[model samples]
Target: MVDFGEILTTVGDFGFFQKLIILALAFQNVLFPIFFCSFLFIQSDPERHCNTDWILQADSNLTTDEQLNLTLPREEDGTFSRCQMFVPVEWDIGAIREYGLNETTGCRDGWVYYDTLYDATIVTDFDLVCDRSNLAEVVKTIFMAGLLAGSFIFGPTAESYGRRRTTQLPVVLLLIFITVAGVSPNVYVYMVSQFIVGAALGGYRINSTVLEWIGVTKRSLASCMSQMFSSVGQCVMAGLVYAIRDWRRVQYVLAGWQAFIFLWTPESARWLLGQGRTEEANKLIRRVAAINKKKIPENLLDVTGEQEVQTHSGNLVAHLSKYMSFICVLVILRFSLNLGYFCLILNVGKLGLNIFLVQFLFGITEAPAHFLCVWVLELIGRKKSLISSLLAGSFFCLLTLAFPQGEFHVIRAVVITALVTTGKLFLNWGGSVCMVYIQELFPTSVRQTAVGFGSIAYRGAGLLSPLLNILAVYHWSIPIIVYSSLTLTSGALSFLLPETRRKELPDSTHESNTCNNCI
Candidate 1:
């Protein structure tokens, strides 16, 4: 039987053709960070005070500071209350100033946000503060639900159809939905738009799986490259948000970028061959050969290998039952990584520092971490790398508990910020390593199915992460404790999985079963 890898070598592995595909796919990955991290700024609970400006009718000569002092109650910390204000009374300015009214009520007029960083965010625009603050987490949860739905839809669509069609369609949908989200008239409309945006983002995982066709030697490189591009996007988003301040404009910029990019992307020839489309696969191979200046025999793909593999690919349930242990561990690890990584990211505003600077640090640190992850993956192999990164990430997550919980101190805030950043970096590294590891561990016949199941777990954790972050209001240590526990458990269980470094990708259930025994 003529394997696709053999055909790839005959043409050229990691040649110009492969590099171009990687670049296109990696560019799409940038959207992951943009969408995921946008919440940090978009839902930011910025400094706010009650809208007590009705007093200005009587106190025309009062300064801004004087109006606030007269119309709002102060907390023990000496800051004006955000949700409460002194009841308005029709009295002269001098009389009210001397009498000092004490009755208070909810900010009936509304809030007056003092957000110097952003001119408008979902929180500010929608008034999702005080009693309405819980809505912010609900919006994130809806987006994650969309991600989960997309995983279920796109994963099988890629397997039944082709990877390129499934991937390309989402890019177009994402652009349209992002534009809708940008100009949303109200919170309800924005939530729906965000859901569609998340569904579109799910296509990126399918796009990434397309790169698995490259030879094993460059598979890690491809994975790391995609991750680095995502990190770069995070940095770009930080700069854009810093400059624009308006979340709507930021969404517009992201949508505009999508319109021009990804016009012409190539299909995965390996996937075409897997679907028994010999002529299409042959033509793509010849094109790659021509671009790489290599020649291939006419009978290069003359084999029934792919058809035989397809017979075993039909029943996802059968694969799940057959490889229960391997699939479950991958799913658990995905859940753990997603939960830990996003928990830290969503809490960026909680860190008592400049949110933009902290977010930029979060973005900038990822490139080096991914570089280090690739080196670690090459040095110790996939299984060990997963274990080490997860455990290290857990350690950092645990260290966040050391920060004082009562009040925000600059020194404590700085230390906790560093701890969370380091923790997030390690989890991000684990996620990058896990991306390649999933492609390598499963047989080609059931690989996408396995990834789909794992993605369900990943998005499930994403759905929970924001809700879990809300628990911080009760006790600051609650979310960190939960994150650390899950990460530690995943790291410990990673010992049971097999290593697949430098090994040929399995094409059948029998081969995958053999690989499963190698641990």
Candidate 2:
């Protein structure tokens, strides 16, 4: 009898072809953030313009040349006339003038009109006063909540239905929500769409499955490549935001791009093989081999399952009994890292930096950080590397708190940005290490459930970070302190974890039991 499981496992392992797919799958992650973050540019309040009613008034009488002379160099000449423009005449100019608006070159000469959109009685501030007040934060919160929900859903679904179906399911759903979100008529509709997008994103099971398919030797490289792709997504997102200034339009573009991904992407052969569908698995493998211009191994094509047993058969209680502790640690660490990283990224304007430029710089810095992680993982090993990075991040968070506001804003910005970026690098590395660690720690009977439980921490953190930011308004250092403490604690706890450097992945209960220290 052929040992089909062994052959499938060996053939499905990572190779040059698998690397290509991992790279391709990365495009969606990259695009998702780009589309999502683009909204920041439109909704930004760097100059606190959210409540301002500055209508560019064109002078109908003035010729084009005259209009050009009055306007600043940056304003588009076609839209406004040379004439003075003001908000509704009823607005209180007394307060505006008190702020030195009347003394300014633009305000005094009637070249620019500035009016406060806030009415103490009517309530005009959309983010703070209206139904959608703090809509951006709400969107982020809900999106992450959906991810938590999706993470649970994807694990079993992928294990049961195969990785291909589970992976493709989210991509389709992402496309749908992205389209709807782009043209959302109101904040409610937009938030709802974003929630769905987050849910769909949660369903994706490709990263782990893809890594599983590769050889152990290539796993770290493949995982690193995955993080690199996420950075690429950030960079791509930056460019897209620059092109599509409108928040809704950017969402539409992202949705459309996700839809395009279905064209060439393939399902995981390892998943099919695991499900006792060798023929189907071989078919998918052949397709990959074709793309890479390599011949499919004859023995791989003849693979068969060793046994037929129902894999994912249990409830929350059963999963908890097996892997709750592991899940808790992962969730706690992921949440802390995400809280600090995202709060830093999403609240760029609050830091008093050029929002776009800062985001651009953040994305650019990831490249070096990623490369450094690859190098560090090799030189220092995963435990020390992750701990050091988290410690450094905590230190920088303290530095950010210690700096006096306003005097050295630029220097503060650079240090915080660099530290945060570096921290993210370590976080990514730690996450990958944890993923492998958890798989080895759990029994195959409950592996997916265990991983899902761990992922909840990640999604849960995403949901909470935005709320933390909102609270940071009152005490900015609170969130940082919380994040710093959590990271330092997680780093220390990691020391207790047995190092799995260069060990073969554990499969059976006996193997897992023997490697308890590593777990």
Candidate 3:
């Protein structure tokens, strides 16, 4: 019986047909970063102060600075208190200014946020500051929960139903959920909508299956290219956030952009072949051949051992039993990467610089990182690539602690930004390498299931990443310490993983277990 790899040889692998499919998927990826990275701006803690405008009633002539000076206490850093104000008195302006009202209380009105980067965000609109500050991070965690929920629901669905149906349905749902999130009347409603958006995103399982359509030699290239486009999406989102500072408007634009992905949702022929739908699989192969301007033998899939096809559809439990050790290591590595990567990305605003430029620089760095990952994965192989990048990321992550805390200086900000950006660059390299590495580790039947396991581990880490910022309350460097520690341990653990460079993707558990070149 001819396997799908042999058929791809006849169908012109990595030719016009595969390139067109990749282009469509790449365009869809460009839209994903709007969701992945939007919160860096959407939920930012902008510069704020208590709305002491009530003091203006007593002193009508007082300028804005004068009003704040009389009404609010100043911190050691010389910034006006964000949540406190002096008790109002009927005394004249001269007497209040002379006495300097000593009684302090929480703002009876609200806050005045002079956010330099954003005119309005969920933080400003909903007053998620001071007491309610932690709520913003809670919302991010809930969204990641939605992603985890979606992965469990849709990852299996893709294995059972076709990839095209599973992918296309979520695009429509994302449009609806994101629209609701844009116009959410309250934070509760917005949280629900964003959770649904995360769920929809989880359901959109496009990346793992992209390799099923291409040949082995092109798998790394396709994986890197898809991630590069996602990086491009981050850059585009940075520009979009700069253009439209309103978080709600950013949501509306992202909602409208979901329509583009609806144009293309191709099924994986290898998946079809594994499902034992020979006729459908043959038609897709012929179509691929036709698009690539190649001719295939008429009886390409005519001879088949039905039992061998059944082996490609084996259940996840059976496959897991055979490869539990490898998969567990992958899950841990994924968790470490997600925790470290997101902790750094979400903290971009606190770098004390132009947030938009910093965000853009972070996104742009990923492009070169992806390219470098492809080179390293091809040259040094997956195991070494992951170890080296993770170690390098850990070093840069530690470098963030060199400067003192609680004070912002231009030189300090520059050094911090450079260190964090360089760390992100290497972490992104590890991420891209991990993705391709996962695809190679599992067989066709259980690939999505294995990816489901990795996603669960990572999304759980993603949920915790935002909350890790709370560690800053204890000490500013605590979160950085945590991120560096996890990445370092993950890098050390990577030695247990085997390399699979330029090897055929395993078709079954037996194939995966018995492969001699997996070393």
Clashes of each: 0, 15, 0
lDDT head-to-head 2 vs 3, winner: 3
Question: Which portions of model 1 show Cα errors greater than 4 Å?
Answer: 42-81, 84-109, 304-314
All candidates' lDDT scores?
0.80, 0.58, 0.80
lDDT of 2 at 461: 77
lDDT of 2 by residue, 317-366 (tens): 65455555556666676667666666666675555565566667667767
Q: Is candidate 2 or candidate 3 better by TM-score?
A: 3
> What's the TM for model 1?
0.89
Residues 108-176, candidate 1, lDDT per residue (tens digit)? 987888745778888888888889887888888999888888888887677677677887888889889
- The count of backbone overlaps in candidate 3 is 0
Error of 3 at 461 (Å): 1.3
Q: Which portions of model 2 miss their true places by more than 4 Å?
A: 1-14, 44-132, 205-209, 262-304, 307-320, 406-408, 439-445, 517-519
RMSD of 2: 8.1
RMSD of 1: 3.2
> What TM-score does candidate 2 reach?
0.76
Model 3 Cα lDDT, one tens digit per residue, 327-366: 7888888888878888887888789898788889888988
Shift in Å, residue 456, candidate 2: 1.3
